[model samples]
Target: MQTPTPSPGQAVLAQVLAMLQPLVVWLLRSGVGYTELTAALKPVFLEAARAELARIGGKQTDSAVSLLSGVHRKDVRAFGQTARAVDVRAQLGKPTPASQVMTRWLASDWPDSLPFSGLERSFEALARAVSKDMHPRALLLELVRLGVVLEEEGQVRLCRQAFVPNPSLEESRRLLAGSVADHIEAGVHNLSASDGKTYLEQSVFADGLSPASVQQLEQLANSLWRDVLAAMVQAAVPLCEQDEPAGGNQRIRLGMFCLSAPMELNAPNNNPPDGDGDAPHAKDTR
Candidate 1:
């Protein structure tokens, strides 16, 4: 006995059903409602199947063919089951009645009771606390003395110009030594203490460099600060925010976050040009 071949119309119907099966499964898994799934899929598949029937020289008026014009029958049944399961859990996850999600968030250790507090405030408070041996309150006083902290609406903040330094001539000399060593390694042997001071003066006096370069340097500095600050804030802020706390690990995460990038990318490279007029290759800073 020979197996019977399916008609062109039957073959088109089978292809349409196969194409729609995965979409049906996705809708069920995504928790679409049974009524909604049926309503949405019926119109889409019916039109597609009708077009398929027309292409295969079949009559749309035939009842047997029209029955296959809707979404896959097996998917319709599975959608009902999946929708029921999701609906049962909808109330539990819904944000309407003050969700348990907040409860879980509050239960976990964040900086304070108000979970939606501004991140800047948390960061400023953490920076102040990490700076000195005193309490957060006392550190604020010290910061004010150093002309870095400011008061606004009873809240403390770091001043905008706090990142700038007024390094004395002596301290500048010491800092320049290390910077010179770095330049030497990069084949920029001409840099001296005078050259470092000249660069610093240019940076200080000029109407600021290009915004793109400044923004790039600021972002890089902030990124490095964030890594160090995050660990310090996690260990320190909770203790400070608490009314009373033990005193054990109380040290500033050693560097100032407000300072500018230690190395200036905008500064002209002073290295001697190679025979080909290309810049000398430098060792990786990292």
Candidate 2:
């Protein structure tokens, strides 16, 4: 018997698995076991099944949900029953202590550098201002370890200009899951949308750049995004405080990220001539 050719759906599923494998690894490292993952996944499947079935004008019965989700009917009902509690828990991310300190630090004004021992407007004061519960010394040590602050001459100075103080793998995965999911949501909406207006998805791509130039590009992107984020926070604060009319309030995720990866040898490559009529091989893929 001849082997069947791969379909487009198979290709898409393969790509999704490729993307999901890393997230699964991160989840495993973060102490989410396979059982926990399966339990967590059941709710997601039930939700998607219900939505799709409803969109198709079908009754969202337990059996129907089970059929659509490929989960047992009892499991589907259990997922639906537990969805509210899960949502409430999801709303509260249980932010790490270190992240809370960083958020509060960036919210307030501080000197470029401050002496650690000063009674007023000192590093200790700043840390206390961020969190009275955590010891200032502990906060200082954490900040230094995370490379968010520089310690020298009995003074501590801010290092990172953005919210990513710790830059831990777990934190990265958290952001990755959220932001990428939101992006995919927008993309899916646009896929079937009648109007041509698209979500704010854009990127700059270039290949054959020197390592120095890539570093320069990274710096440029970081600087611009920092300014943009500051402006967003400053401008959005008052607007966010205003009471909503009848329509209700809105939540948003306006974010910018900088990513760079070396081109892979096995990856597909297409050479396009630059303005100066040079066909340099490019390796970067977005």
Candidate 3:
């Protein structure tokens, strides 16, 4: 007997289900159920449908949007114009002052310790360089409060190489949303593009790894990310300054992630390594 092939929509839905697993886990853990999710998604679906229709030079009437998005015509027509006019990205809020200082510290060639006040190579100078709107002392206090740094005898000592706010905090939640939203947006853009433009969204996947090997691979990923982060920041700073004076109409995000999980017992086995010891099966999304 031969296996039956799925239709295009069925195949896409299958992949979408796989992609939604992690998000569903998050939603359930946060006490959001299917009803709440569907309610929240109504406006989003209409907005996305309108955008798609505009992109393809189709009519953006309520009926057209409803047909494209599978949303009811009444709901599409009822979507408040005022709400639709608001910029969604602006609602995420800007990065905190402490995170800004932390990023510059990690990316720059500055020393681990700097005096509170000085004209050159000081904590005050670094903070002001990032933003003149915020006082350096206030930024230092914020970082200290977050346990990211320590102030000793007028010198601020770096407590860690990276800064991560408490997960339960609102700041961390917003940050996560912003990052994940951009990642999904990139993938959506690539999927819908007709002109061949694409963003770099590749990942390498391998299965059947021991726990120890997975841990080692995670460490390697972190090490590699540190190098990439520093290099990208160094290359981007001058360009950003140059662009800001010319209106700064664009932005960029470079991210890296790693996940390891045990394979299901009933799942098909991945192909073993060839004679050359190279794994024969690896998933690469480009």
Candidate 4:
């Protein structure tokens, strides 16, 4: 059997479909319908068209956007005039009950590792201090769910220094949109670069590893990623603490991730280890 060579357009279309499969799968699992996806993509498609025109130094008008975006001119105008829909859940930033509880636990004066009940400086007292309207028990349960605190022997202990409230539906939706958008934007920017200059978009990948080797690789990668995370977080903390001077609104996001999985299941492994099986894998500090 032979596979026929596809035309350039056919090849690109196939690539797009292949790349979109995982996202579609996620959307389906998340209970988002195709119609909902289409609605969300409209503004994104329009924005993409606007970006393309700007890249080429072309004028971007409602009609031009409609033509480039394949959207009706009226719809395009409406999208431009309308305020972007905001996710109400995302606005409840850091000062949430979970963060307050964790921050209070980290305070120098607080020191009670045992299960706290009616003590003067107990878990309930601390939760009550920061939780405001929420009950102490409710705050404690939420904290446990978020992995921010642990309860044992009638006392609660802080597990994580940072507060990451359990991501609700809207939080997950926002993260889905933001992270994938940035990732695709990086890829697109690199693809459209004609001057041989590029951003720091890179990944290390390889196949043909045994399960043992894969485990070793994962550990090595985890160590390297942890070091990078620590350095970046340390650098970011000072910036967060500094006073915000009056200026135009500007924000930045730094994202890094690591993935390791079998590329194909049931693939034959021909290569075997030559050295001691316990030999350490090469470490990458970066």
lDDT of 3 by residue, 1-286 (tens): 9899999899989998998998899899999999999988888777778778988999978788889989888887778543253444433534687887887888777888889996488999889987789999999999888788899999999986445447677777787777777787788779977788999887888765777987998989988987897898888878987899889877677778788776664234554345533442455454
Sorting all predicted structures by TM-score, with the top scorer first, yields 3, 2, 4, 1
Q: What number of clashing residue pairs does each candidate have, in the order they appear?
A: 0, 0, 0, 4
Maximum-TM-score candidate: 3
In the range 1-286, model 4's lDDT, one tens digit per residue, is 8999899879877988897998899778879989999888888788778877898897888988889888889889888945233433223222466655665565424663735687887888877766458988888887677776788878888764433324464544565567566666567678766868666666666665677988887778766755665566556545644633434244444556656665443345623357523333344341
Q: What's the true lDDT of residue 5 in model 3? A: 92
lDDT of each: 0.44, 0.68, 0.79, 0.66
Model 3 C-alpha lDDT versus the unseen true structure: 0.79
* Deviation of model 1 at 133, angstroms: 8.5
Per-residue lDDT for 16-87 in model 2, tens only? 788789778878777888898888777778877877887889997899888888889877766665642233
Where does model 1 exceed 4 Å of error? 1-138, 168-218, 232-275, 279-286
Who is ahead in lDDT, 1 or 2?
2
Q: Cα lDDT for residue 136, model 2?
A: 85
- Stretch of 10 with least lDDT, candidate 1: 95-104
Candidate 4, residue 98: lDDT:
62
Candidate 4's C-alpha runs over 4 A off are 1-12, 54-57, 77-80, 83-142, 151-173, 193-197, 243-250, 265-286
- List TM-scores for all candidates, in order: 0.26, 0.64, 0.86, 0.61
User: Considering only N, C-alpha and C atoms within 3 Å, which residue pairs clash in candidate 2?
Assistant: none
TM-score of 2: 0.64
